[model samples]
Target chain A: MRGEAPRGAPNRLDLHDLSLFAGWDPGGRWRLFGEFELGEALVVREGRLRTDQREFDYERLYAEYDLRPDLKLRLGKFLTPVGRWNLIHADPLVWTTRRPLTTELPFAAHASGLSLLGEGAWHGGVFDYQLFVDDSLALDPDRGDRPLAGGAGMGLHDSFDHALGGRLHLLSADARDGLGASLAWFRRRGEAADRLLLGGDWHRRRGRLVLDSEAFYRFGRSADDWGGFLQAVARIHGGLHLVGRYEYIRSADLGAEGGAGLLGLTWRFHRAGVVKLGFQESAGPRVQPDGWILSYGLLY
Target chain B: MARGAYRSQVGLWSWPILAVLLMGISGGALAAAPGIAVVVHDPALAAGLDRASLARIYRRWQRIDTAGRPLVPVNLPADAPLRRAFTQALFRQSPEDMRGFWDERYFQGVSPPTVLASPEAVERFVRRTPGALGYLPDCRTPPDLVVALRLRWPRAAGIDPFGLCQEGD
Candidate 1:
């Protein structure tokens, strides 16, 4: 018999952050699991004080079953497994901080609903395909005053109304040696829209050289927008990594392209933990002063 | 004058004596190489694997067999010197680090490779199951079993050369 845990019990917690996670998996042919998260953080936006914000969130609660070797069924609230960076949790990430603007602008981390996942490998290539139906709720505190809308904006209320989307991933043969290319697509319901993302990464172990580049084309009913980002990281021995990234976003509604460049270094004391220091400067159309960022992450 | 002559003669004699003693020790150690075997149930598989491939299989990177069955890899006790040698040759990471890697994987719903306690246990399990692969000391190899890869510990050279398969003694 498979082991089981109680529903809604605290399975993990971090005192420094005052965060708690509770989850349970019931033993059955169809496995069921659920998780909850509660935490607090301080934010300063537009030089205004947004301090000590309390957040009560349902991280994930889902049931999954394997119908076949290549097909699986999932239902309930879960993280949208779209981008490579989004599928894995932040704590286990290679970088101390996440790719800002891009990941945040679309949606919050998880959606509640049903999904179908298919994964397989053949001829030295790997593929992951997913189809999902979700009722999403955005969690951005700053957007509280904005009126909700059914499509494209956070105005959609607790109406059983749903969204439909999917993603497809095709990886090249040389992924193990750290050189590969991938293409991904996502489309949400209620808006006549879609997004196509293409990305490639190359890495060499001898000198610790890495290059990552990605392009996104957003197609909507009114007008289309395009954006691209590139990042390079080099290990300078003694557990220090230097990184640089450039990003640009252009839309039909906007007069000119807006973008930012980041220069950073990360120190890794352990495989699952790191400390990072970086400077970000925004330019073109809407410019912001170069600011410094310090962050740390731990994974268990 | 006689004392000086004796001291010089003794110094010359000591150099040749030390060289001859060191050569004898190395030669004797080479003459008696310990017999360590790499054992598996399938003859074809035993012939197909090289050192690098075997290492990859143990590391969970190569999950499928030539015939497409999910390969099940097993190893001896954690502290066994042979196991250490095998992992050192295969993973280039310490066993403790490998354990940590697997623990994280477990949280992600992935299972690590199965571990067995002894060579005899590995041999018995491999003999009874298909898709099972393991290693054992050469002298205990069963006739029905095949020799997939062989490793020898070189006391003289201070390194263990792995995946060297040869016919008979």
Candidate 2:
């Protein structure tokens, strides 16, 4: 599948991926995968609100590769290997709103990277582990104007920054009748500022019930202090999801706590799409006294 | 004397009728299919798999085998009765729900298992593949395959609109 390229299309780049996955038995080693997606969004980053009116992003690229039964390595930009929600994307999640004040504040959600992932079992349960490294662009500096505990300015400092992180996950053999937990960490070293992050999530689902919670702590020595946040999500029915969160931040120069309470609903229109709506109330020294947000999201 | 006669006569007919009804019920119960076998590739696996373990393997949870081979699960064609039986006994979710489940995994960079055309194909594939696993009807013993678990349709029946497997037998 790799050799087909549209000729005379010099500006059109040809990209492909080959992945081979096998079970313990030889017969399960069939190769499968291919797809391409075009994504675009427009964002107006001004004042307190960041709105995307028109923009284009390559949300996914189709490719293939398969070698060695026991290991598989993917080469391309994939979703950032971070918390549960970020890894799974927006569609399959139970909650309507993106994780509140805490979950979205810390990490970049997607990156171009090489991912090495494997799964096996030990101690009578299933285990999945992954290690990945990526080259990423720094966050736009103008996006870092929030009042953090330790005054840290956010923006691009250099061009050649990179990040590395991994996750160790454990689940019971039964997907619906098991517990899943993971630990992840990442760091980016830019010419002017460096950033470090550590985070994890604990999740459980049984029958119609689901529970998931995650925490992240970020530190960098560039301009301000260290900050982190914790977010939790619970699903009672397939339709209604409840969320709660807390955030604590310590600047290199100052120490304070920033926190919020979030209650939300994520209604799945179908498995591929969903509608999310929520309310957030902040409670902390450095929080928006009357800050509330409304958002709509989609995944396809 | 009259009261005693009336009581005796009522008891005589009631016992005879009840006995006949009980016998008829027992006959019908005995005629039903015996316990169904959950077939796999390794005969020894029959000893290790419980309802929970078998459920996990079918759901693509425990993908690796005890011997370190990755476990690939094969399914019958979308309309097979045996496939319905296996999925009903295992996932409790409908085929549509199962597709949605796999879609989530796919977007997350996980691939779903390959689907085979028939039970014969599954048996042939599993026999050749070391870590491949699939289920078939318990009627015949195919060569080179194992029986992993036994499943009985629950007595308390409900139309599982979502095709989710009932929990814990």
TM-score per candidate, in order? 0.58, 0.58
- DockQ of the candidate models in sequence: 0.06, 0.13
Top of the candidates by lDDT: 1
lDDT of 2 at A17: 19
Interface RMSD of each: 8.0, 7.4
RMSD of each: 11.6, 10.9
* Reference-based lDDT, residue B22, model 2: 97
lDDT against the true structure, per candidate, is: 0.54, 0.52
- Residue A295 error for model 2, in Å? 6.0
Model 1 lDDT, residue B77, Cα: 77
Please give, for residues A178-229, the per-residue lDDT of candidate 1 as tens digits: 3334343444332334544443333333347656555555554576666666
Q: Candidate 1 regions off by >4 Å?
A: A1-35, A41-52, A89-92, A135-161, A171-174, A177-207, A251-256, A284-290, B1-169
- TM-score of candidate 2 to 2 decimals: 0.58
What are the per-residue Cα lDDT tens digits for candidate 2 across A1-300? 011112222211111212222222233333333233422222222222232323223443323233333345666555666666666654344453434333444555554556776665555556676677766544323212322212235332212246677777776533443333433344433234556667666776655555566665666565444344445556657655555655555433224456555565656666655555555555443322223333444444
